[model samples]
Target: MITISGLTKVYESRGRQVTALDGVDLHVREGEVFGVIGQSGAGKSSLIRCVNLLERPTSGTVVVDGVDLTALAGKGRRAGKDLRRARSSIGMVFQHFNLLSSRTVQDNIELPLEILGVSGAERSRRALELLDLVGLADKAKAYPGQLSGGQKQRVGIARALAGEPKVLLSDEATSALDPETTRSILQLLRDLNRQLGLTVLLITHEMDVVKTICDSAALMEKGRVVETGTVGELLATPGSRLATELFPVGGAATGPDRTVIDVTFHGETATQPVISQLSRTYNIDISILGAAMDTVGGRQIGRMRIELPGRYEENVVPVGFLREQGLQIEIVEPQDEARGAAEGEQAEARDARQDESQIDKQDAAPAATAPALVKDGAR
Candidate 1:
C-alpha cells in the first residue's frame, strides 16, 4: 500500500514558478490497480515521480508500506545499502522501455537481481520465471532492438519484477503501443496485479487504460486532484468536467422542435431498456444519431445521442423518467440557433392555418347570400 499526503512540487524557470503538484493526497491499497490521469502538466508525472523519490517533492511526503521515502532523501550515498533494499521492494517500468540494448533479454531481467546481490543460480531461475510471467520466454536471448514495442515493455515489466517487488509503478507503459497492443499490455498488467497481489500505480493521460485495469482512479488537473473515486462511481455520475473525458458525445442539434440529449449507459442501465421504453411511453419519436459502447472491467458502458421530435420542454418528462431508471443524462445543446428557432416557425404555420380557416368561413357566408339572391331573381 502507498499513501501520499500534502504532496506539492514547484519548479522555477525564467523567473516564473510552476506548480506541478498542489497538495495532492492519494491512497492506494494493496493489490489495487490505481490510475492517475490528467492532461499535460497535470502533475501526474510529478506525483508519481515523488513516489519512488525520482523527483523530490517540494513539500509533503511519499510513504510506501509505512516507510517515508522523502525522509530517506540524501541518504543515497551514506545509507547506500538501505536505499538499495528499499528500492528493491519497489519496481518501476518507464514510458520508454529503458532496457540495455547491448544486454540480452535474460541479462536485462537478471540485472535487478544481480544488483540485489541475488545468487547466480537464483538470478537465472528468477529471470526465466519472469520471462514466462510476461509471456516472453522465447525472447529471453533477444536484444531490445530485436523486439516490438509491446515486447520491450514486457521486458521492462520483467526486469522490474526481477527484484520481486510488492509495488509496481507503470509510467505510461502502454502509451507508445498501438491500440491492440495497448489492450494486450493492459490486460497483462491486470493479470499480474491479481496473480502477484501487486499494488500498481499507473500514470497515464488515457482514461481508457484506467478503466481497463484500475479499480479506482484520480483525475489530476493543473497539478490538483479534481476528481477521485471508484471507476463505478465515476462512470455513474461523471459529474466532474475531468470525468467526462472518459465519455464524450458531441453533435449539433437540429431545432427547438427537437431536443438533443446525451445519454450515458453504465452498470444496470446499460442492460436496461430505459431509452426505448421511455420513448414509447411518451409516444415521442426518437432518433439516434451516434453511439459508442465499450467494456470496462467486463461491464458495458455506452454513450448514445438521442434526438426527440418535440419541444425540449416536452422531452423533459422522458429525461426525468430515464434518470429515475438510473441513466446519466445530459442535454446536448446545438451549436446552431436553428434548433430553437424551429418552434417559432411551427407557431407561425399554425397562425397561417387559422387564418385560412377564417377565410373559408367568410367565403361561405358570401356564397350563401349569393345563392338566395339568385333564387329570388329566378322566382
Candidate 2:
C-alpha cells in the first residue's frame, strides 16, 4: 500500500549538509506489518517521517494507495489542504504519547475527527468506537496522567484511528514502555492490522518488536538500507545479518581437533529432534553451547551452537546429514582451550617416547660398560 522510491532527505546544521535518509527504497504491502530497525542514528526516524511528508524529502516520491504525497504540494515547507487531506488517511503513532494533557481520553481521540470537520455527535461516536477498538473504552474520561504508560499509548493508538486510516505509521510507539507492556502493545498492533486489514510501517531500534509482530523487516545502517526481506526468506538466506541478529546463537570456542557448528531450523524441521538424530547417526557426542528458539507468526524458528567430538574434516559426513534434514549450518572457528589441549597431548606423547628411548639406551649402556660375553674362541 506504500511505495517509497529513492527517498532522500537532507538537512542543514551549522552550514553543513546532513543526510538523514540516503537513497532508501522500501515497500509495505497491504495488511502486513513491515518493520524498519536500526541504531540511534541509522535514519529510521527520518524514513518514517518522510513516508507521511512530515519531513519532505529532498528528492524521490512517497506514494500511498496510488496517491503520490510528494506531488500533492509543490516543494513547500508547509502542508497544503490537499496534503493534509491525504495525510488523514495515513495515521501515525508517536514514541511519546503526544496527547493533550488538558483533554480527557475521549477528547484526545476526537481531536482528529474535529480537525476533519466531523460533527460533535459523529466525533463522539467515532471516539468511543476507537476507544473500544484499542481496548480502552472504560478510560474515556481518564486523563493522560491518570493512566499507565501502556494505557496512554492505547489512547494514542485510538486517536490515530479516529480518521479510519488505511495505513498506520508507528514511530517507536513502544520504546518508552516496559517489556510486558511492550508485548501487549505489539499484540494489539498485530490484531489491529489483521482486523482492519491495515498496512503498518513501524520503526524501532528494538529487534524484539520486529520479531514479535512484523512479517517483513528491513535493516538500516548509516542512512542506507542494508538488508530487506520476509522473515523466513532472511532466515534462509546465507550470511543474512538481519537473520543472525534476530536469532543470536552464542559461539563456542574450538580447536584443531574439535568442531563448532551453528544449526538453524524452521517449519517442520523445528518439530524434529535433529540433534538426537545426528548423535544417533554419527555416533558422535555433541555439546550444545548456546541456542535461541522462538515462535514467530506461528512458525517455530531456532538456532543452536553445538560442539562435536572431532574436527570438521572428520565430521564432514555428519554435517552433511544435518543439511540433508533441511537445517542451515555454519562452521565456527575453534576456541583456544581446545587448541591448547591438543598441543599438550602431543607434547606428552613426545616426552613418553623420549623416555622409552632413554631406557633402551641405558640397557645397551650396561651391556657396553660391563664385561660382555665373549665368543668361546676368543676366551
User: Per-candidate TM vs. native?
Assistant: 0.80, 0.85
Off by over 4 Å in 1: 14-16, 74-83, 257-259, 309-317, 332-379
Per-residue lDDT of candidate 2, residues 1-379 (tens digit): 9999999999999999999999999988988999999999999999999999988899999999989999996766889999999999999999999999999999999998998999999999999998888888899998998999999999999998889999999999999999999999999999999999999999999989888999999999989999999998888787688987999766445445778888889999999999999898778788897899998776899888899987778988999999999998887665534554577689899999999997786577655554543343257
Over 4 Å off, model 2:
333-379
lDDT of 1 by residue, 75-179 (tens): 343444555577778999999999999999999999978877889999999999999999998998889999999999999999988888999999989989999
Q: Give the TM-score of candidate 1.
A: 0.80
Give the clashing residue pairs of candidate 2, or none. 253-335, 254-334, 254-335, 255-334
lDDT of 1 at 278: 79
In model 1, the Cα lDDT at residue 177 comes to 93
Residue 66 alpha-carbon offset, candidate 2, angstroms:
2.0
- 269 Cα displacement, candidate 2 (Å): 1.3
